[model samples]
Target: MNTTHPAKDLQVLAESLASVAKVTKNLDVLIFGAGLGGLAMLEVLSQSEHVSIHSIIDISEDAPAFQLAHELGVNTSTDSSAELESFRGDIIIDVTGDASLRSKLIAFKREHQVELISAKSAKLLFDMANQELRSERTIETQNSRLSLLDCMLEITLQLESRPPIHDITSRSFADIHSHVHAISGLALIFDKQSKAPQCVGAIGENAPDCSEIESCQSCNGIILDACSRLSQKERYKLFKPSIQIKCQAIENCYNVALPLWQDTRLSGVLLFDIQAPLSKEQKTTLKMASVHLNMTFKTLDHFQQLEEMAIFDALTGVFNRRKFDMQLHQEVSRIKRMKNGTLTCGFIDLDDFKQINDTYGHQTGDLVLKHIATSIESCIRDYDLCARYGGDEFVILLPSDDAMQGSCLERIGMRILEKVANFDLVNAPEIKTSVSIGLVTQSGETAHAETLLKKADEALYEAKKSGKGCLRIFADEQFHYTPSKE
Candidate 1:
C-alpha cells in the first residue's frame, strides 16, 4: 500500500487484514520489541479490527517501551525477543535493533520453510503498514507537494542529466498521446550486464513487474539505432554528438533516462516513464532537482576526501591538531553526562624541536611528524579521533574505565602510556616518537565545558614538566580556575 491516498491505503490494509482474518486465528499480533516503532505499529493495529495483540515482548521488564505498551491496555511480557515468532500470525513485525535476533529469525524461517501460496492480501497489509510507519518519521523532513505532473517533470530532468539512477524502469514508460496527469510510476537502472534496466527503486504503482532487467522495454519495438549507441565502444567515442537525440528509451513511450555512478566510473543508467507530457512549472522542479543533485555529488566527494585527510597531519598530511581538540571536548562531555563513559587527554612535545630543525633539518623533522601521525591513527578506533596538536607536539584522547572510583582520568592515563609510548612507531620503529601527556577528567560537579578544558591543559603542562614522555593529572579534581594551556 505505497499509496498517496490515505483512505485507499487504509481500505487496502483493511482488506488484507480481512483476507487473513479466516486463518489469522487467535489474532494476536506480537511485537518483538516494544520500542517507539513497535508501539507505533501496535497503535495502528489496535485500530484495525482483524487482529488482537498476543503480547509485546522485550528483554527489559522495566524498559520504557513495555510501560508504554501496557498503558495502551495491551498485553505485555518480559521475555527475550525469540518467543514472539512462534505465535500465530500471517505476518510478524520485528522492531528490535538486535542483530542476533535477526539471525535467529532468518534461521527459523529457513528451517520451517514457511511459504504461503496465497499471501497477496497478507503481504499487502504488511507492506502498507511498514510504509505508513516509515512515512510518519518523514513528517519533519519533506514538504514536497508530490503530483503526477511533478513526477513527469522530475523524470524528464533525470533522463536529461543522465544521472546515475537509483530507481526507475523503462517498462513503466508509457507512450504519451496527449498531456497525461496523476499516474503512478517506477524508475529502473541497468548496468553493462543488464539487458534492460531493472526496477531497483520506485515511488508508486509499479512493482514485482521488474523482477528482472530484460523486462525493461517500451514494446516489442525498440529503436535499434538508439540501442546500439549504448555499446561501450560507442559510448566512449562521443556517441553523444549524434546519438544524444536518437539514442534514448521508448520512442513512442514517455520516459526519461539517467546514468549511475560509482567513484569515477559509470555503473548504469535509469529510465522513467511518466506516461504524459509535463507542464513547464513541474519541469522547473526537475531543473531544481538537477542543481540539488549536483550539490549532493560534490558534497559526497568532498567528504570522502576530508575523511581520508582527517587521518593525517594537515600541514604534513599527518594527524593534525584539529582532531585532538575535537576528541578532547567529546570525551570530556561524555564523562560529564554519564559515569560509564570516561576519558583522558594528553599533549606531547618533541624534545627540542627547534634544535632538531636547526641541526637535523626541518625535512627530517617533517618525516618524523608523519611517522608519529601514522602510529597514533593505527592505534585508535574508528570511533576514536586523534590529531597533531601543532609543531612537533601531538595529542591523544583515550577512553578508560573508572577503575579507581572517581579518578577515571588516571585509568585513561595508564592506557595511553602503554598504547603510544610503548608501541612501535611508523617509520622510525626503533628510535620511536615519544610523548608527554597531561590527562584530566571531570567526574563530579565539574560539568562546565570551560572547566573541563582548562583542567585538561593544566594536566598536560604538568606532564611536560615531570620529564617528557610521562603522564600526569591535576592532584585535585576541582581545579575550576585553572588557566588554559594551549
Candidate 2:
C-alpha cells in the first residue's frame, strides 16, 4: 500500500489547477460536484489569477465544497439544473460521475455552446496541467537560484575592498530592495558611545533622519520602538528568530526588520516595508541575504581591530612609538624635498604622573595618560601628528614653511597646558594633572628626524628643570622658556 502526503498532494493539485487556468484566456469554470474531486478543484481554481470560478453545485447542500465556496465568496447551490440554466461559463467540469447529470450537462453544453469535460477527461487534463506546472516551476526555481547567486557574488566582491559602512549599507539596501520590492528601507547601526540606534542609510520618501537627532519626530513611534527594542541584547533575542510588524506609518503595509549580529552581540538592523506578504521562497532568500550582511559586518570589524592594533597605542589610543617613527621619517623626507621648509617637534611628558598612580592606583594612572593624550590631540592642528613615545611621554610633529614663527608654537603649548590643568579625577578630586612640553623648530639646513627628537628632548629637560609644568623651546642654538602661568 502506498501512503500519500496530504499537504504535498494539496499543493501539487493547486499548482495543476492554476496552470490549467493560466493557459486558457479568462476561463470561467463551473464545477458540478462538491465531494472530494469538486472540493479539490474549487480550492485551487479559486486562487488562480487568470481563472474565475463561477459556481459549484451538488444535490446535497451539506457538501464539503459548499462551505469552502461560501468562505471563498464563490457561488454555491444544491440545484445543478437550476445553476446550469443561470451559468454563463466557458467550460463545465462534471466531477459527479453521474450518468444523468452528464446527460443534462451535454444537453446544456449543446444549447449554450459551452465545452463540457466529463470526469474521466477531466483527470487527463489535470495530469497534463500538473506536468506543465512542474516544468514551469523547475525553470523558475533555476532562474531564481541563479539570480540569488549573482546577487551574493556582487556583494562579496564589493566587500573585498572594505568600503565604509555607509557604502555597504546602501549597496545592501539596493540589493535587497530589488528582490523584496519594499516601499521604504532603512539601515541602522548601534552606536557604542550614544548607546542607541543611528540611522546610517535611508531610502524612500519622508524617511526620517535619525543619524544625528536624538529622536525622529516624523517616524512612527511604533517603528522607533521596534528599532530600539532590537538594539538591546535581551530584547533582540526575543525577536531574533523572525520579526514582521504592521507599519503604523503606511496603511496596509508591514515592516520587516532583520537583525545583523556580530558574534553574540547585535550590531545593526535592516528594515523595510512590504505592501504584500512574502512567499516561503522569498523569505528564505531574505534570510540568506541577511546572513551575508552579518558576515560582512563581522569581517569589517575584524579588519578594523587588526588595523588599530598595528598603528595605535593600546592604552592611550594614539599612534604608538613605531608608527611615530615611520611618520617622522616620511615627514623629514617630505620637508627636505621642499624649499626652506621647517618641521617643529614637541616632546610632552605628564608632570607627577607616577605620583598620581602611586597615590590613587594604576587604573587612575591609565586614565590620566588617556586624558593627557586627548588634551594634546585636541590642541593640535588637523595636520599635526601625536604619538605616545613611551610611558608618560608623547611626541607631536608639526610641519610648516620658513615663514612659520615661534609664536604659533607658543600658543599650541599654552592651549595644551590649559586643557591639562583643568583635569581632575572624579573619585580622587584632590589629584591634579599638568604636562611639561618642549618645542624645537628645525629649518631645511638641519632637518633630521633623529636630530629633531634630540633637540626636543633637551628642551624638555630644561622645561622640567625650570619647573614641572612649563614649556621650553630650543631654537637658533638657544633655549627659550615659557612658564605655565599665562
Candidate 3:
C-alpha cells in the first residue's frame, strides 16, 4: 500500500497542466509597438486560429510591422494612449524592447486585468500556447476574407455600369452604410468657383437633409466653424485636395469624411456615421468607393456640358430653334392629354430691325437683340419657356388653365416694352427699338404646334399693318394697336 501511494504526485501534476490548457484557449491579443520583433511575434501568433489579434497600437503607421498586421486583417491605430485606455484583452504583448513601453504596459497591468507578456517571456511559452489554443477558427477567418473580396468586386462592377451620377452616389452611400452598419451617410459636391455644396445623396434617418439642414444656420455653422479653425497640419492634409474630417463631437457620433478630388480640383466630400471608429480595412474600402464616385461625377458633368451646347442658343443663352421645336411638340402633346388648359403662343418681331441695322452698325443691332432677349426672359414665369425663333424674332409659350383670359400675356408684353425702353446702353446711345407682339390661344385637344405658330405670326403681321410698336391678338376678342408716346 505504501508503494502505491508514492506515484500519487504524478496524477496531481496532470490536473494542474489541464487547468493551464483551458486558460490558453481563445485569447484576445492587443500587441504594442509594431517593430521588427513585434511583427515576428504577430506572424507566429497569427498561425494560432484560436487567438484573435484584436488590434495593434503603434505610433508608426508606415512601419513594416504595422503593414503586416493590416495585411493580416488586424485593426490598427496611431492613438496608442487612447487605445490602451479602453482595450481589454486576455493577453497584451510588448515586443518593442523599449524600456518606456514595457514600463507603460506594466503600469497598465496594475489597473486592468490582463496577462502581460514580454518578448522574452513570449518566446519561452509561445509553442505551448499555440498547441493549447488550436481551433477551427481558421475557416471563419478565410470566410471573412472571401466576404470582403466579394464586396469590393460588387461595388466596382456597379460603378462601371454608368448609372446617373446621383443614383451612383446614392447607391454607394447605401452600400457603405450596410456593410459598416452605420446609422447614416451623405455625399456632397460643390461648385469649384462658388464652393456652394450640393448634396448628391443621403441615406438613413439621421442623414442630413441638405435643403433643410443648410437652411438652419446652427447646424451648418458647426461645419463651417470647423473649416475655419483648421490647423497648419490639418490644412496640409487638405493640400492634397482631400482630408478625412473627423467630427466626433459635432453631432455626438463617430463620423468619417473623405474629400473627393478630380485631378487637382476639389469635387466634393463623402461622409458617413460609424458607431465605432473605422478600422484600417474599412478606411481602404471607403476610399475605394470615393474614387469611383468622383469618376461618376466627371462623366455626368461632361455629358451635361455637351447637352447645354446642343440645346442652348449660342448668342442669347436661351433655347435655340431646334430645342424650341421639340419642346413645342411636347407641349402640344401634353395639352391633348390634359382635361383642361389653354396653350398660348406669342410671336415677337423687332420693329424696324433692318432699318436699325442700316442706320447703326451691326454691332449695335446685336446689342438691341440682346436687350430684347434679356427683357423677355425677365418677364416670363419660371415654368414658361422662351426661345430665339429666328433673326429679330422670338417665341414665348404660356400654358394656362383658361383660354378666355389673356391678362398675364398683356402684363408680360407691357413689362417687356417698359424694360427695353428704360434700358440705357452706354455704347449705343442712338439705339431705340420696340417689339410688335402677336398672341394666339389654343384650347382644342386636336390643335397642332404649327397651327398655333401660324396664327401668332398672322396676328404679328396685322400688328405691323396697323403701325410699329403694338400688341395684337388673333382670338375672338381682338387687340388694337396703340402707338407709344415719345
Candidate 4:
C-alpha cells in the first residue's frame, strides 16, 4: 500500500534525522510503526557518520518508515513482530510503544544483555535543537537587534549538513520566523557605494524590492547618487552622533540604514528601526551580527581551503588521486561544451623516494617532498593545475591558449633539475630526489579527461624506463583511466 505525507514535512523530517545520524557511526536499530516520529528518528540515524541505520520495521511495506528510509539511502523492509536476536539492531526504539516489541527487547536483555532507547527518549533531540538556536542568537551575554545576514549565519550553525533543508525548514518555520522578527522586524540590505538597497530573501515587513541598496527615496527630495557626492567622516559633525553614516544614501534613510561593507565596497545595507527607536540590547545585535558575518565568511573560506588541502599530499601539498578524478570530470565537461579547449596534463613520479625514506627516515624524505612541492608551485602558472597523485606521484595540468604544453613541460623539467641540485633541508644531511615527468595535451576535444590521464600515466612509465628525471609526452597510443579532481 502507498503511504502519503506532505513533501515539505518529509524533507524537514529527513534533514533532522540526518543531523542525529551524523553524531554516531554504528546503529543496530529496530523501529516499529514507520509513522512520522519513527521516520524522524530513522532519518537522524542514517545521516550520521560511522553509523549505519539498520532496517526499520512496520506492518505495511509502503509505510512512512519504508519510503523515507529508501530516500535516506538505507536498507529497509517491514516486519510484524521484530525479534531482537533475529534482527540486526544494536538498540531498538519502540516508537509504537507496542508491548510486544518492548517485551522482546526486555526478554533479550535478561538472556543476552541488550541496551535500548525508548521512543520517549527522542524528545531530548528537540530540546537540544532549541538550545542550539538560543546559543546562536545570544551575543556575548548581551541583547541586540539582528540583521537578516546575521540570522542566516546563525541558522546555518544551528543546522548540520545531515538534515535535508526541507525537513528543517518546515519543522523550524515558526521558530525561525519568530527568531527573525526578534532580531529585526524588517531587515534591509543596501549598496553603500551607490546608495541602492536590494531585496534578497527577507523575513520581516520592511523588506524592499531590489537585492542591493538603491537611493533611499522614502521621503527624499535630494538624491545621493554616489560615494563621491558625500563624506561620512564630516557628516557626524552636523547631527551630533545621530548621523550614524557620514556618507549618505541621501538624507531620508538615516534613521534605519546599517551599512554592510565587504572588501571596501558596499556589499549592502542591513537596515532596521526596531519598535521603540533603538534599545542598547538591540544595538548590540547589530554589532554581534557584523562580527558573526565576518567570522562566518572566514569559516566558509577556510572550509574550502581545507577541502583543497585534503586532496594534497601532506608533504607535497598537491592534489591527490581522488582530486585528479574530479578535475578530469570537470575538464571533460568543458571540452565537451567547447569542442576546442587547451587540455594539457602531466604525471610525475619521484625517483628513489622510497630509497630516501628507507635510508634517512620518513622525516627527511618528507622534507624532500616539501621542497619539490615548493619548486613545482613556483614554476606553474596560476591557471595551471598541480596535485599530489598519491605516494610519490604528482600531476599537473596546463590549459594554455597559445603556449605549447611540450615547451612548457620541458622548461619545468629543466627548472626541477636546477631546483633539486640546490638542496637545503634545514641542517639535515644533503639528499637527492628527482621526478620523472609525463605530459599530454590536446588542442581539440578528441578524448575524455580520463583518457588523457591514462595516456599521461603511461607516458610517465615510459619516462621512468628512459631515465629517472626526464619527461615524456603522449603520442598515438591512448589509454583510459578516470582522474581525480584537484
Candidate 5:
C-alpha cells in the first residue's frame, strides 16, 4: 500500500537529477556578426557570471566591432559556418538581423543538439545590457566633472596667489595648456596709444617670440588679419563675449579669441587653438579663466607703463643717459663676440641753443627738443639706439657689419640735416636751430664705449670750430669736417 520496493529509490534518483539540472553551468557563447549589437552582446556575455563568449564571426575584417574584437584578443572569423560547425558551442547568438541566416541556424539547431538564438532575441539581450551600461556611464561622467572642477579650483587659487604679472600669465597659460586640448596659443595685450596688439605669452609649436612686449610687432599682422575678417556686427558681439575663428590650416581646430576689457577699453586678447564647438563645461571654464587673464594683463600693463617712465627721458620721450649707458654696454659686448665688428658713435650738440632759449621761453625750448627727438626717431633704424645724452646734447649708437663701408652713417647724417632744416612749429617764428654732429667709426672688436664717446666728443668740438651746421667724421684719430652748403 505504501509503494514499497524500488519505486521509492526511483523517486529519490529523479529528485537528485532535477537538483543537478538546476545548478547553472558556464556556457561557451559564439557571437555571429561583429556589429554594434553583436559586440554589445559579446561584452555582456563575457562579463556575465554564468556565461562566457569564446569567439566572434563577421564577413568583413574591417568592421568597427571586428577591430574591437581583435583588440580584445577574442578569436574571430570571416566565415560564420566554419566557426558554427567547428566550435560546437553551448550557444550561438545571431545579431546580424539576417533572416536567411536565422532560418538556416534554426534548421541547424534542429539537427544538432546545440542551442541557437535568433537576431530578435539577441536584440533584447543587447538592449538590457545597454541600459545597465548607460547607468554606469552616467555615474562616471559625473565623477569626471567633479574631478575637473577640483582641478579648476586649484588653478584659480594658483592664479590668485599674487605673483609677478608675467609669472601669473605664464602659470595661467601652462595650466590651460595642460587642461585644454589645443595645438597652439598666443596671449596678447593691447597698446591703446599705438592701437597695436602686443604678444605677452605663447605656447606650443610655431609660437611667436616676443620677449619685449612693447616694441615687438610680430603678432600685429596676425591680429590685424583676424580683425579685418570680423564684421561690425561680429565686432559688437566681442563686447559681450569671445569669438571663435576657424583656422583652415589646422583641421578641426578653432582659434578662440577672448576679449579682455577694463572700463570699456579692450585691454588685451587671450587667443588659443582648440577643437571647435566646445562643451558647456569647457566654455564656462574658458570664460572664467579669461576674466582672470584680463585682470592680470591690466595689472601688467600698468607696471610696464611705470617702467617706461623710469627708463625714458621725461621731455624728449627718448632713452635717458642711464639707459643709453646700459644699451652701449650691451652693444659693445655683442660687437666683441663678432669676428670683425664696426661700431659708429655720433655726438650731436644743438648749435646756438642757448641763444634760442634766451629768445624763446623754456616752453619753446622744450618744444624744440621734442621736435628734434621726433626727427632723430624718424631717421634711425629700429635696432639703432638714440638717447638724450644730456641737456641740448644727444648720442646715437650705430652697429654695422665689417662690410658696411660707412655709407649708412653718411645717409643718416644727411637725413637728420634735412629733417632739422624743414622743422616747423606752431605759434613760433622762423627761428632756425642747427646741429653740429661728430661721428667716430671704429673698426675691430677692441673699441670700448668710453673711447668711442671721447673721440666723438673731440670731433664735435672740431665741427663746432669749422662752422655752425656741419658734420665731422672722425677716423684713425683724425677729424674730417664736411660743411653743409645750405
Candidate 6:
C-alpha cells in the first residue's frame, strides 16, 4: 500500500540534481540495493571526480540509499528486473549482499556483456574511493595552510618598513578576501582613547558605503555590538581571535570579526562576509592571520614611541637640541641650492628665568618653560622649526624665498612676545616674564649652520643688552633694533 507521488518526487529530484551538478564526472555506475552498504557506497562515489552515478535500485522505495540516490539526481527504481532491461551503464555494483541477486546479476552480465562487480569487490572499491577522497582533502587543507603562512610572512616583512596603517589594513583585507573567498571585507582602526573607529578600509563589490563620516556612522553600531560580545579575557590577549556573527546587512551570509590587539588593548577589528560556513582549516588560517596583524600593530606603535623619544624633548614636547642641529644643517643645504632663497635663524633667551627658579623652586620654573615653549610653537608656521636649544633657551629656523623676510621675522617675533606676556601662573599671578630674541637672516650669500647660529646669538646678546624684553635683527653687515609694538 505504498503509493509514490510522482509529481512531488520529480520536483524534489530536479532541485537535488541541480545542486549536485556543481561537480561533474565521467565513469558511469549502477548500484544495487538501498541498504546501509549501498548508502555508504553512494556517499563515497558522489564525491569522486571520475565517477558519475547512473542508477540505483532497491526493492523498498523508502530505503536510505534509494532516497539518497534520488536526491543526488541518479535514476532509481523499485523493480530491479525492469531497471536492468534499460541499464546502459559501464558497471553494475551489487552492494545488497544477496546471493540470489548476485547469481541473477552474473547471468545478466554474461548475457548483456556488461561488467558485474560482486558485493565484496564493490565494498573494496568503496573503501579505496573513500581513502582517495580523504587524501585529496588532506592535500587541499595543507595547501591552504601554506598559502596563509606565506601571506602572514609577506605582511610581516612589509610591517618592518613602517608603512602607514591604511596601507597595512588595505593590503591585509585584500589578501584575506582572495584567500577565503569572502563576499566583502572591512578593516576599522579604533582610537585608543575614544574606543571608536577612527579609520576604515573596505574592499569588494558588496562593501558598505562607509567612505564618508555619515555613511560610516551606520556601521559603527554593528561593529561595536559585535565587539562587546567578546569576553574581557579575549579582548586583552595580544592575539585575540576572530569570532562569527550573523550578518544583518546581507541575508544568507555571516561575518567573521577578528579583533586586532596591541598588547593588552583592543586596537581594531577586521570583518569579512562569507557566503558559506568556513572549514576547519580556513578558521585556523584566520586565527593565525589575526595574530600576525596584532604583532604588526604592536611593532609599529613601539617604533613610533622610540622615534619620538629620540627627537622630542620629554619635558616640553618640542624638538630637542639634537634634532635642531640636524634640521638646521639640512635647511642650510636647501638654501644653498636655491641660490636666491632667504634663511632666518632666531635665538631666544628667557630673561630673569634663574631668579624665578630660585624664588619659586625648579618645579614652577619647569611649568614656565613649558608655557614658553607652547607660546613660541603657536606663533610659528608649520614649515618653521622650533627647538629647545637648552634650559630657558629656544631656537627657531624659518626658510623663505620672499622679499619681505625681515618683516616676516619681525611679525613672528612680535607674536611670540605677545603670547609669552599672556602666560599667568596659578600660584603667583604677580610674577612676570619675557623673552629677548636675536634674529639673523641670510639671502643670496654663502651660509653655514654654525655661522648663522653664531650671528643670531650675537644679535640676541644685543637684545638682552638693550635691557631685555625686546627683539634685534642682524642683517646687511649691521645690527638693527626691531622695536616692540608695546
Residue-wise C-alpha lDDT for candidate 2, range 1-486, written one tens digit per residue:
215455555554456456656666688889989998888777666656767888898889999999999999999888777888788877888888898788888899789877777666565556656676778877886677578668777877876677877667767777776676667776766656654666677666556454433254334344456755654233112233334333333222235777777776666677776554666556766777776777788888898888789889999989998888998889898888888898999999998888888888999999999999999999987888999999999999998866357888888888988998888777988878888899999887678988998999999999888876899988878988896653
Per-residue lDDT of candidate 5, residues 314-375 (tens digit): 89999988888888888887787888788888988887888878988899998888888888
* Alpha-carbon TM-score of each model against the true structure: 0.41, 0.62, 0.59, 0.43, 0.51, 0.81
Q: Which candidate is the best by lDDT?
A: 6
Q: In angstroms, how far off is 460's CA in candidate 5?
A: 1.3
lDDT, residue 19, candidate 2? 63
Output the worst ten-in-a-row residue range by lDDT, candidate 2.
Answer: 232-241
- Stretches off by above 4 angstroms in model 1 are 1-200, 203-256, 260-269, 273-292, 299-334, 339-343, 398-432, 475-486
Q: For candidate 3, write residues 243-323 as lDDT tens digits.
A: 233332124232566555554566555556665555655655555555555555666566677788888887888888888
Better of 1 and 3 by lDDT: 3
Overall local distance difference test of candidate 1: 0.50
Clashes of each: 20, 0, 0, 53, 0, 0
Q: Which one wins on TM-score?
A: 6
Q: Score residue 442 of candidate 6 by CA lDDT.
A: 88
Per-residue lDDT over 1-486 for candidate 6, one digit per residue giving the tens place of the 0 to 100 score: 225454554454444334434443355778998799999989998887777787788988888887778778878888899888888756788888788898899899889866677566666666767888889989987887788778778878876688987677767777777777777676777777877774466677655444442245445665676767645244221222443322433222235767777777767776776654576666776777777787788898899999899889999999999899999889888888885788899999998999999999999999999999999999998899999999899999888875336677788898898888888888999878799999999874667888899999999999998876899988887898876534
Please write out the lDDT profile of model 1 over residues 1-486, one tens digit for every residue. Answer: 323465554565576456766554545555666666566566667766666766777776775567667777887776544454455455445667566776665665466532221123333454676687658645422333244336445655555344433432232233111122323433434354644544554333333244432443443124233444443222111222232211232222325433333344444433334433545433443444333333444444565577768765655564566665665566666666666555545565555557646766677677666655665566655665666777777666656545223355445445544444554435445544456566554453354446655666776677666665566665455421222222
407: Cα error in model 6, Å: 2.6
Model 2 lDDT, full chain set = 0.76
Question: What C-alpha lDDT does candidate 3 achieve relative to the native structure?
Answer: 0.67
Runs with alpha carbons beyond 4 Å of true place in candidate 6: 1-27, 66-72, 82-90, 109-121, 191-199, 203-205, 212-216, 235-254, 263-265, 275-278, 337-340, 444-447, 483-486
How close to the true structure is residue 93 of candidate 4, measured as C-alpha lDDT?
A: 60
